[model samples]
Target chain A: MQAQLIALDWGTSSLRAYKLGPAGAVLEQRSLACGIMHLPIEPRDIAGIYCTNGFELAFDTACGDWLDAQPGLPVIACGMVGSAQGWSEAAYRNTPVDVASLGQALHCVRSLRGVDVHIVPGVIEQVGLPNVMRGEETQVVGVLQGLGTQVLIGLPGSHSKWVEVIEGRITHFDTFMTGELFAVLSKHSILGRTQQPCDQFQAEAFDRGVQVALSKDGQRGVLSTLFSARTLGLTAELSPDQQPDYLSGLLIGHELAGLPDHARHKPIILVGAAPLCARYQRALALCGFAHVSLAQEATERGLWQLAVAAGLTQPVTEA
Target chain B: MQAQLIALDWGTSSLRAYKLGPAGAVLEQRSLACGIMHLPIEPRDIAGIYCTNGFELAFDTACGDWLDAQPGLPVIACGMVGSAQGWSEAAYRNTPVDVASLGQALHCVRSLRGVDVHIVPGVIEQVGLPNVMRGEETQVVGVLQGLGTQVLIGLPGSHSKWVEVIEGRITHFDTFMTGELFAVLSKHSILGRTQQPCDQFQAEAFDRGVQVALSKDGQRGVLSTLFSARTLGLTAELSPDQQPDYLSGLLIGHELAGLPDHARHKPIILVGAAPLCARYQRALALCGFAHVSLAQEATERGLWQLAVAAGLTQPVTEA
Candidate 1:
């Protein structure tokens, strides 16, 4: 079973390349820390002259670099790697976007190595204050394909996205810096100074954080609620190892609390790494959302759908 | 006139010394970046043997180091310099506390050099979850003295405090990590990567941030609203240079928005460095608070009042 297409999820810190079979199943995948930002050459000059360890390289050389043991397949790339600062600037597609429309808006860059390359355009909400998502849109599209209904979807990661999918189109969405905030606060803030590293998640401490966030009745919200992580430690109610899980719960709880009223009552399709999805699942349950389902291979599925829709790959028959 | 007493505001990052006249007026003042953390001696051995640049030192050496020309005067110190890891562990005074009670709670350490030294006890709210304030209590006391009535006081800094005073007593208060959040985010987060050095505050950008925070209608609060700083930049709604002020406005706006509903309707007495207070004043006005007053010499005045209340200094008549 030879690889039929390459699906790339290129972000700031890492690059994931999935080799998809004819049936759109992930045949094999490779990941490297050499993200867009790690490239030796500037994004503008990446398409032209560039060399890595005495080898001449083009901007699209990532596909070649990762396919050392296999032949190069047609590539479909998403995430920040397609931004203005990426290999080729793929203009953002405005909202009310669907998988088909996103496929139509794909930015095809001429590959120097004769392999076809297409970059998915990110989605932008242009009404009022603008909000944009690059890599998450792909996963959202993937979830849309699987769910195929009006569903509230949450893609949680460094930057979590909550989208309202209505009739297979993204009607509205919001991006929360919850993961980033948790990272920054835990690593840099006073509340994080005493945090001891732990391998296991402390559900008790996490639940305490969720309870506090949910029970908040005063005008004091996240800003003040955050201080409790420190106070709880100082008062001996929380231990050093418990701080991380508690902080995670607090942040996730706050994010869940902020969800639009309509999204809160309904079941949410959560898409992301298992650990983060599980944390969100717990927080969602605590926030009164009864049903929270997880979707696997969201990025791969979405990229595959976009590839088929864009005529870059053939539709795979079901088993 | 001879210096009657020394008032010290010793914090995590810096130490300030004010030489007060008989009436508690600041006759002369000095500051150094050598805060408690910078001291070479351990908190336990601070009262014993220590040396700075080959000279013998003690727990009260900070006052001695700064008072090279004048005779050593009795000192009143406040802030984190009195924490468990500070010069001496001053106990926290649980609140619903009055300035008189806090003054009475001052921990006077017997100086080896025979100089009288009193460290003002910090206030702790231990009813539900423990919340503590060190240096701000002094300033709140000062504001209470000046206002002599019920008032909502905001002490803005690394940790901003919103306090309620009735009959010259601190009835309740809340702490916001706004400034610290701004510092960590701007210096460490992705939104801060494009920030450039600028001396002047960008009012237009700041107002935009405040407006966005105020206009937030969905479940997305600060976590979501913060992304606008990045999105607005990507979409060209905000520039990199304007990010600092805009972030300030956003955090300040969120802090103001989180204030107890009753506090928002009343005028707030803001006490802090001029620049921070001015920014808060602007944010408060934008958030619909009609009256905002600035309290000058808050820390010094508060320290003086504590000294008099503790009977550590002679009460002098105001000119």
Candidate 2:
């Protein structure tokens, strides 16, 4: 029942910690607003010393007490916490890497609590446009278990990533700015003027948006189709309440359309927030992606697999 | 020379007034920061009457002196002044409308000074996605005078429009939120965080962006290429100063790529701010669009033609 590894999913705005037991099972979990960008700033005492560093303060607040009861728990962290601006820089590892290869490249940062936190290095694809990812790599590593050779993993978020794996190695990937683009367009652009937020999901409008993205007009690309979000409202085709979901569907559709050609024949796996993944699931269905499924607890599982791969923790045999 | 017509080009952010002599020649002109959205709020006396209406105040300020000198001059206005939110709603005229046709449908709003201002109605294309234009319609009408039978007119700005005119009739048109997207992403998104303003145009970066949009990767759409604006910077391939122009070029390139198939074979005319038009010209060349040209004084010229078409002014014989 004792914890074997402490896994931290630290991102730009939020931090999630998991206490994994024998056989890589999640024993306890905690979430904190202590992501690198919003790290704790208040001076706090840690290991008989006043810790002034934001990373140290955040690290202590996130799981300092979890380590108190069991001091020997090996720590593993992923995401922006290993970037250039993280507690300690973990240089990015090139792509065509797997959990085993990435596990060998984990960066180490010693905290004031006398614990060495192993940080997972983000992946960088040097080919083409040079795509980079921080936390999604770990999630991809977690989801690769027992998957076929032709696998397309989608991690949807502010910057949605479509990663293609060939026999457990991430051979190629693409990043789409759909979510962030939608956010900025809705909050700061002229499109925001007419959008009226509604509680009920406007499935019709959302479907219409997805359809439009697949239609010939959508062939013009999103920059052109985006105007339709407002024009449809002006023409009263889409009510105010339907605008947001319509936009969401439209952006997701465009992102789906932008996926590399190899994704079409592959078995797709989606990992992200449930709501966002649900949106992608709907869009993927609309896209006629034959084989698709959603992943649960991807981050913790990926971190656990990575911990085992790194020899930092061993998976216990059950019964 | 005596002024024959008073022409006002009023839009969302600025107003320009012109006193036209015989032959629709500009005799005098003035510009004011009083577009419909930024109308004057200060109450003032107009023709001995204290008026508080924003439209009236803006109208008086833009050309009250010209009207005072010749109160009998016929007045014509165009742009957002005819929008639903303008002085008086000049209901949008359906597309396939020409200058003569639009002039016949001008809506009249009487000012505090007892002068009737004929406002040009904007054009709306209800086909497909329902495109609408307020100010750009006038510019299109202006640029259409001597153009060929087949014309593809591009007016690039906050919302760039491409109007397809066949034998002087606006048969169809499309709108791209390219300019507005560039502005919002540069000002409010994660991409903006790494951008640094530069006085000089990053021509190389701009050209690279355009190329990327036309490349095989660009076939995936801008929602994907947009990530390059940041990844390129992260990889040290694009500097802070180059990011903005690169994004601008990328958006413009995608917009050009979205233009209907018919545009390639026709003569293309661009009407907008000079610098923006120049950027489009560069992008057009990069896009292999050979038949591209720039226009000047499109608004005032279009307003003058419309006024003459309405029998509000006569072309004086040159002596």
In order, candidate lDDTs are 0.80, 0.89
Q: Which regions of candidate 2 are displaced past 4 Å?
A: A317-319, B317-319
Q: Write the per-residue lDDT of candidate 1 for residues A1-319, one digit (tens) a residue.
A: 7777889898877788888888689888877766777754433333354334211143345457545456456789899878877877899888888756788788887664455578999999988778888988898878776464778999998889998888878878888899999999988999889888699989999988887777753236688788888878887889999999998888888877778778866658999989889998888888889768999888998899888988887887555
TM-scores across all candidates? Answer: 0.93, 0.98
What DockQ would you assign to candidate 1? 0.67
DockQ of 2: 0.87
DockQ of the candidate models in sequence: 0.67, 0.87
State the interface C-alpha RMSD of candidate 2.
0.8
Q: Which candidate leads in lDDT?
A: 2
User: Residue by residue across B142-246, what tens digits does model 1's lDDT show?
Assistant: 777646477899998888888888887788888888989999999889889977757888999998888877885422578888888888888887778998888
Whose DockQ is greatest here?
Answer: 2
Off by over 4 Å in 1: A40-72, A146-148, A217-219, A317-319, B40-62, B65-72, B146-148, B217-219, B317-319
Clashing pairs in 2: none
